[model samples]
Target chain A: MTKPLSTEVDALSARHPGVIDRPLTQRFLPFAVAFVLIAYVFGSLASFDVVRVLSGTRTDLVNLFFLDSYAYKVHAVRKLESPEFVLSLEGSRYAVYDERPAWLAVTGEETDIDLGSDGRVHIKGDTLEYYPKDEEVAYKIKFGPGLVPQLVEGVAPDWMRASDIQVDMRPSLFARIWITKSKIEIHRYFLGWENFWFDFDSPLNGKSFGEIASLAVSGERMDPAMANWQYIFFQFWNNQEWQHGEVYYALLQTVIMALVGTLVAGIIALPLAFAAAANINPVGVARFGIRRFFDFLRGIDTLIWSLIFIRAFGLGPLSGIFAIFFTDTGALGKLFSEAIENADRKQAEGIQATGASSIQKYRFGIFPQIMPVFISQLLYYMESNTRSATVIGALGAGGIGLKLLETMRTRQDWENTAYIIALIILVVIIMDNMSGWLRRKLIEGSN
Target chain B: MSAQVTLTQNPRLREIGDAYERLSRSRSLYTVLLIVVCAVIIIGGFMVADEANSGSFWGGLSSFFDYPADIITGTYAAGWGWFALVWSYLPFLVETINIAVLSTIIGFALGALLSFVASRNLVRNKLIVFCMRRVMDICRAFPELVIALVLVLSLGPTPLAAVIAVAFHTIGALAKLFSEVNENADMKPVDGLKSVGATWGQQMRFGVLPQVLPNFLSYGLLRLEINVRASAILGFVGAGGLGAELKKVVDWNYAADISAIIVLLVAAVIGIDYLSGWARRALIGKTGTI
Candidate 1:
């Protein structure tokens, strides 16, 4: 054994030069130029205007806190007049105001009245407040499109009454990307294109049904009046940088969560993984039980795990983290255990034959042999888990997935959705390159 | 000195002593940990499970009593807790199996092609291998759910989208596996092919693929089993399958169906495990190989 080891060392050294002598000019020069070109291009494209990106990101955070909806648009924002804005659409009526002290109450609360008997309507006290000192106070107005003459019937400030009732084209600049919403609806008060007494009436309209059977028969394309994708992209792209920047943040969050989950998984699983290896245990029962346990945990989708944990733990980063861990531990554990089991048993035997304890044998022999494989697995899982995190996050466990869902539901922000997803992909690409480089380093000699 | 001499002379006594010592030292800890894990999984799962709403545990057990009849008749109304009995639509359900098998086959076929180019041993062009491997990595790096979501949104959520999503993921997974297997194959045949002035294609066809078939089939079949379970959930995204029904049941607060679906899924998995084991053993027998 001692003679063989010395001879193996001599042979390896004789076959391969100790120093790397590949011509840098031939092998690396092109890569250098390509790297620079890519970096420059990405930097330029990503920055577009450095000043604007920086300012926009900062401006967005400020606007977001105040619940400002006009983050991107500057010209002709649909501002409420005199602190009160009232509108009636689709047989529904509501009043809106700036996010100020005085609050407005737009209610769909119903009160049945015998119209013929009531000569005059009795009003309740303080139905609406234009500018209440506290958030607790809100203005109350009684208005319905069902009453042909009026959709909004209340005494507001004279200037407010005269002001145009229009929705702000700009949602708040500081709007929370996932949660904040800006809605604009054209009410069908008087009815159609040829209809209505005032601006309260919408020129365009659509129908709805109470039941699914009735709905399918209505012959309405589910996403009727679907906007062009290019048009949607352009519209959102023009919005202030900071507001749109939240979408990137959301995407960043998705990638970060994925990485964190993967890291946490590797950190916790490494020790257990060592024990789980078949060679370490050698006992069939021990190996079978551990392997099966790992399988059960990793067998399901991260989303399913997320769903299970979400149900049990409720939605948040915590739930997502646990879900990621629960699955990743199983997966990484399997990979690591297999790697350990596959490592040259001779190395461990050599250490053990020296009368070393199991721990000592593992540390000196198995650990060194399997360390590279473990690192490779960890790197791959990190890249892989990033994709997983996005899906798992969609389980409402709080990450980019939540943001995407909210954006789609509220604004149908396809552009932002695209941006968020694009960012996740970018992060993954970077990780892929890094992992590839590492794997090359690890496997160079063996290959 | 006397004890050492006796131990050396009689190997049996020393072996028995070592076995006893190893067992006495480690057995208790392992048994305890295992028993604790089993207890938590078996008991805690039930304790936390929404069995009360799902029909009583006993009620769930009893429903399986009439599973065959119930599977056909059961819909939104006549659901059994333990037996999802979607067995009546076994044809539609088998379609899920078909999708799983077909997608796995298709994914790995394409992946195998890519893997041939990606393997370092086969391809001396570092750039090509890097690109191909990166492509596979990216493809597989994505979880099926994300792919499903993307495909659903773009393609208007068809079963075809689900199939494509599953296939792409399979490509990613199987490509990497195939590449690794390719790297590990015996080089003798490849060397022989090369000596005969065989083209790279001929070398792969005649030299390489035959040796790797069992490994590829094993991995592909294993993926198929995984995909069957995965595709089952694809329905949650409006893709076709039993998972769609599973989602519907969950949405409608049908606890019984949830339990029934889980049970069915577990059973399906066990069945696949048995089938995979048999196949692997048969292949091993033929090849005298792993």
Candidate 2:
């Protein structure tokens, strides 16, 4: 029975070769496409230096971005020539030194620093001494007329890196010191953003959260002119380093840009969509022209649009909004016209059979059919435009994107960059959920 | 007329009439309220944005076409040189396209793997699925520009930075889409293969891939279109591409040069859109017409 069946299958294949076997092109087309795609990808990646990126060196950069975005550095600089000591955070000059910090002390002719586990360092005029923790021998360097520091006593420990002009020492991950001929600088690292709540000038800068809370509740004022909570709020809002107030306002501008841009685009596109829709507008040329116009609008990238608008509007959220409006008009018009074209013909016919006027037919017949699609599409674009607004803002349209670009340009304010990024993501996610919920409600409601 | 009088007199008919009126009224009321709320938000938001903007809306509106007019005049004056300018910028256009292509390829491969893990129908472990979904979410949440900008800081404004950033984002987007596609797939083939002593990988490769490959390819082609736009935009933020060239001309106020780049970019985008749209339709519309 099996042999007979096999012979029958062979006969069938012989009778209908096309049905049993695929053509050579069909068999090899996918493989050919895959080969081309792979070749293009690899060629491009090689040309773009993917190897250098995938190499171990980039991990350092990745770590730097991750670490610097979360941590703040405090620097202590003592100018040898002027003989003055200043401690600052994140290399800012706004150091308040009415009195010395506990870790650093200065007497008449000498300065001493407690370098945590690396032991203490005592510096006298023209003489530098390092006392290694848990060790008796102290390494000493005497600063003289020459750039080099003459080793006065003891063997140099591993922590000491003495060069011609500068003596550098890194005791731990959190602390380092650079003693040069011109100045002695010590950097101590700490987790989290420093002066995030208040600037160095604010009296409340060094206070912990618990301390600030107590200060707020104790009926005592951190600032003599205001209540404690008000002072804290003022300091936080007016934080010199972070600028929480300005950042929040920029975020608000971004949100508003998306909202206004999307709504305005929808409004402007509604009539144009009707003109462009084949079934709604009987004139072929007008419909074709309008369709092409929509295409032209969408074809120009939003970045280019914003750049053009920036020149006219002079770098602000308005330009960003206009860019979004223009680009989205083309997009929404295309989408809306398609929705209009796909509207049920039976509904329009039913309305027309009632002896309704054209305007009334459109109002009662077409509008209801496309309303759900129009609304859901609008909401979806609104959410997406929030992201586009951000990108536009970076191109000099005033919003969080511009603010982010500003922080990023500085290169040192990774913490602020991180903060802004987090906020943008949070807002985007919120917008996403909000638009989803609205789409569900509107679509269901329409039915 | 007597039936109408009877309808008015009957308690049940009266109750139903009143209930219908109340329901319709409430529905219309909700609609009116929604419209009012939306109007207020839009109007108020416009005012706030306008106030925050450096230029007033009315003032900007008056001069909205000035820049475009300038660019047009500049391009016209340049005459035949504008074509040369476009020709010169073609390489930058190619670079931008390359960035998109490489990133999309990388994204497609990674996203396919991630989507498999993320799909509830394919993956038995709920925890793994949950974690993978969250991973995609976080990846998607980060805008490409943010990542590209940061990477450029570390990597020194290379196309690789843009590629990685865009590819990272594409992974999340494609995975989400692919997983949704995965959920709707038939399980009989998978079960049959599994019963035949096929390995898990074998079962997925033989039973599921053939079913979902077309949709995956279609979605991937769609992503390629998006990524092309994305990579061009990323170039504006110092990633290497036509956008970077446009940024240069824009900064220098070279109107003719800017228009040339804009033309190239628009042409490229539209051409890609058309090509990809056709390809996608073919892929989905015809089963054997590779």
Candidate 3:
């Protein structure tokens, strides 16, 4: 009886394999194959040697960027004529300091630099000695004839490098020292942006918040021509290193470009949108032509438009504005026409029933329905266009973007780049928030 | 006598009519004022831009079509050679699209993660939401070209630089949009999963993801379209791609080449736009309509 039942079960299974009953491999094989094929294709196309690239990648540039962004190098150069030190940030002449940090001791004969537990570098006329904090042995570097830097044989360590014309000694992680043909220099790395507010030449340099507040209110005028507060304001505003004034102007130009472009585009697009809208424009060919015209304008990207406009207008904010206007006109025309086409016909018909003219029908009946969408989209474009204007400015259409690219090209001006980046970010965020707020207010208020 | 009686007795109706007229009058005045303000701003801005421009608007108007005419004639002169020129730059165009695709993929992955953290309805942690939102804002705030230029300076001019720069921006953009989508998701499914003792990730996967996937995919497609345009633009700033090639041709004054490259670029843009639109519609199941 059991043998017969088992054979029956086998017969039933073989005869009636259900539709849902399939082998797992059979079900998933196509997907698995597709997955593998896609992976293979991407792998071959990207040619990504992940492990090699990751391993071979150097952090030197990133380290430099980070170090340059927040930390600044203070250079104390030993003068040849006198034993005095000319201290400056990045060796800029405008940042020359009459005083020195507490860690630096400049005497008539010897200059001592404290590297804060790393080591001490002592310069005595024609000889220099670097004493590692943990070691007793001091590496002595001698200035040979013609002021060439020379290190004693077998005494130079791995951290300290020496050559005929220059000697670089890394006494600590935070500090470095160099001796060249003309001058001995010590670089002390400090955290935070150097001279962001007041330069070394300013009287307000190194002043605490409370001290600055007091000085602003009660202190004597730092400059004869101006009050203390006025002097501070002017100093910061006209800071030669940062050029905050020029930056502000560039920012203004960017905002203006975006605003003008967006508004003008909206104004131009409104009429063209009607021409593209099928319900508004009865002629099919005309509507098709206008739609394709918009598409052609849009198909040509803003970068191309800007490039062409730059040639015509000869590079300024105007070219950027025009580029934005032309491109946005295409986009806005399409968007606005869609909005118009989607509008309820009842109101328009009702206006027409009341013996209203076409313009009046649109203005009173159609405009109210699409106003919220139009305003919201216009605001959105204005915000995004602000960013686009920056990119256009990089192509020599004038804006903060030009300054940013220019500063970045100068390479060592990373701090200025950081400042400009910060300002741009702030402006963009403000614009974003402002547009959002305005959109909500206008839409809700109209409702 | 009947007209006098109706007029005197319906004083409330007359008052309402008077009030309506005054309101309409004030509204029309405001409208006129707004129009005037807009006109003034447009005119003033135009004047300022004209003054700041290197060439006057009137002078540029005459030569507005000069460059395009030159390009057309040049391309016409080249005849079938323009096609060959376009074909030659195809690889760079592919590189441009690849940069866009790679950036969009990376950006979508990272942005989705960030969006979950940034979404007010999803994340309970206030500080994480604040910090993540601000980080996205900063990322979005940076222009892709600026970042690309900086990266090129540090990392050398390479496609990788463009990819990274565009990716950074995409992350911010997609995160903001994704979070907005997440905000609108129904919470009942999430609550049901939570009642079943599902973990946070499980709840999100089994509940929210299913609901938001279509919208997310739609947004991602739109971002891809945008990223392609951005990557192309970024190439102009020395991050190597078709844009760099175009810049070279432009610098060398190759009018035929410029036209050919532009046609190719326009074609690529329009193709991507259509593909993305179709994909978005399919994902959202909103077919047969614009």
DockQ of each: 0.03, 0.63, 0.49
lDDT of 1 by residue, A402-428 (tens): 665555444333444445555566766
RMSD (Å) of each candidate, 1 decimal? 21.6, 3.9, 4.8
lDDT of 2 by residue, B1-290 (tens): 99778779999998888899999999899989988987987889888877887888788878988999998999999999899999999999999999998899999999999998899999899999999999988777778888888888777768888899999989998998899889989999999999879998998898889999999999999899889888999998888998899888988988899899999999998999889889887889843321
Assess candidate 2 and give its TM-score to the true structure: 0.89
Q: Which candidate is the best by DockQ?
A: 2
How many clashes (backbone N, Cα, C below 3 Å) per candidate? 19, 0, 0
Fnat per candidate, as a fraction, reads 0.03, 0.67, 0.52
Candidate 1 docks at the CAPRI level of: incorrect
Residue A71 of candidate 2: its Cα lDDT?
78
TM-score to true structure, per model: 0.51, 0.89, 0.88
Candidate 3 off by > 4 Å: A1-58, A79-82, A117-119, A132-138, A144-157, A198-234, B1-37, B287-290
TM-score of chain B of each: 0.69, 0.94, 0.92
DockQ of 2: 0.63
Q: Which ten residues in a row have the lowest lDDT in candidate 2 chain A?
A: A53-62
lDDT of each: 0.58, 0.85, 0.84
Pairwise TM-score winner, candidates 1 and 2: 2
Candidates 2 and 3 compared: the better one by lDDT is 2
Write one digit per residue (lDDT tens) for candidate 3, span A84-178. 78888788887787667888887878888887767788888678888878888988888744577888633777878877688998865578888
Chain A TM-score vs. truth, each candidate: 0.45, 0.83, 0.84
Which model, 1 or 3, shows the larger DockQ?
3
